[model samples]
Target: MLEVLNNDWKRLLEEKMYLCVSIALTICSIVAAIVLTNTMQTKGNIAMVVTDQSANTSLSKKFSSSPYFHVSKMKKAPLESDMVQNRYDAIVTMKEDGSYNIKTIKSDDMKKMIVGALNNPDSYVPSNDKDREIGTNIMGYMMMFVLIQGLFYARFFAKDKEEHIIKRVVTSPIAFRKYLFGHATFILGMIFAPTFAVILIAKILGVAIGFSLLTYALLIAVLSILATAFALFLNSFFCVADTANMIGTATITLTTILAGSFYSFTKKESVLDKLVHLLPQKDFINYVNALEKGHLSRNIELQFIYVLVISAIFFLIAVMKTKRDYVYR
Candidate 1:
């Protein structure tokens, strides 16, 4: 296994340009998160609805001036879909009396910010623990790119099959399992290392990541394994690198968005809920949100277990596919 892993890394090292691009993209996303967290003055996005055309704009301007809010003055109320998509953190209907009604799907922490801003316009200080975990924010931004990298990295495996290299290895004394494990390990490390390092360094530098270092490490580790498994599963279906890559890229992008990697929105109906439940990223991000609350619930355990089970199942299927299609055939 070690020998195979070594050979795989050596092959990957030959693609210096690909490695550079991957590293740059991964690190840039993390660094951008850190920079924004440090620099952002507004803690929430609020849509202020004024019913009267001649209404005083001062109330809207007051909320907009507060550090806790980026207020959008709207003649009409924002749509429910906009709230769900996180375009607005909260919707406000302000009366002439200085009182307002707020509707939001965000946590109580965000609700407090809105209330405080309404009461004193100057009172709310952003909490050290932001409404959502910074760790989760990093994951939302970084996950799709890292997973796409996994699909591309597995091109090495696809290339071997295309060039008849895998056929020779399958017939050789070197076990097929070891050869496959080597490729999987290489892909996982390529996906995990730089991404995790950025988080670790940020934590060391006193960034409020909203979770323990150990928890962040575990999250990234699981995500990396799942990404590697996902890549292998797709590649197993199509020996041609381009076809597998195209399908895998589209699947990852769509599923990641639906999973709420960037925004967590609740569905009202059973069918939509069930469809989202099928996605592994949904459970993964749910677990991240759970950890932000600083308690271990049975639901969190289930989400964690679901993510691991899905990753393992993907790998198991890939193994079966290789034995049936490549080796025995």
Candidate 2:
């Protein structure tokens, strides 16, 4: 097993395709981080018009003092169209009766920050928790990428058969199980080593590396293993690599989207949220968020464990299905 794993690693390192893909993924992740940070920073700066004389005085002082808030005071009441046209974050109108009306001109970060500040903090929560939970979510998304790549790798199995490499390996001392495991080992190394390097860079740069590194490591490992099992299962079932790739890509993409990798489905009380709960990504994000808030829910743990169990089941199915054929072809 060790020999097989080492050989697989060596093969992957020699492959230019692996290196190129890793570099591309790293660039994309960095770009995403930059965009998210800038968006958050821009949102923190908001322009507001004070309506109530007393509230205006209090708010002006508060916004001026807080680093998160950028306040602009306007003397006259601006029309809604004017506020929108002028690109003001929000407009505050002070009524003669001492009441106040706050209107958001846009839905940018500035508007969100202003709303958060004006509304009760307890009543209005920002998706900034999603920001904190991003590290975990990124890890999960990467695992999905790994799984997709693993499925792509399954195509190589058929190629090897076409080239008679499977027969040559079968005739050698390499056991069928060892050969499959060797391939899986290689795939895992390809998926994880550079990913961990990225995580290390993120930590050095002062990103809040989550509370339990071990838990995260475990989660990623489990997901990767599941991906490997899925690859093996596809290889066992399909004669053509294209079929496996198409099916794998579609399935993984759908699951990740449903899991809320792009936009969170949890905020919506629609059918999507209920459907997404069955997937691991949403539950994993929820778990990470709970951990960030210093609260861990049993349900979250159960959901994670459920995903692990499903992974195990997939692995078992793959092993059973593939055990009959020692030859890769």
297, model 1: CA deviation in Å? 0.6
| Stretches of candidate 2 exceeding 4 Å from the true structure | 10-14, 34-38, 41-134, 140-143, 152-158, 161-164, 167-172, 205-216, 266-269, 325-329
Give all TM-scores, in the order shown: 0.80, 0.65
lDDT of 2 at 39: 57
Stretches of model 1 off by over 4 angstroms after superposition: 41-44, 47-54, 57-67, 74-130, 203-212, 268-271
What would the per-residue lDDT of candidate 1 be over residues 43-117, giving only the tens digit for each residue?
779888876742475665677678767888878997888977789999988877666799997655677778877
TM-score of 1: 0.80
Give the best candidate by TM-score.
1
Clashing residue pairs in candidate 1 (N, C-alpha, C atoms within 3 angstroms):
none
User: Candidate 1: lDDT of 131?
Assistant: 45
Q: Would you list the C-alpha lDDT of every candidate in the order shown? A: 0.80, 0.60
What is the lDDT, from 0 to 100, of the residue 129 in candidate 2? 44
User: What tens-digit string does per-residue lDDT give for candidate 2 at 1-329?
Assistant: 66666655555557668567754665465447445644554333344555446444544555445545555666665566765444555675544444456666343454456656555333444456435455554554565565676774555564554556766777878887787777777666665555566666766787665545566566557666666767777666766667777887898888877676654424355566788887765666566556666667788778768767766776677666656554443
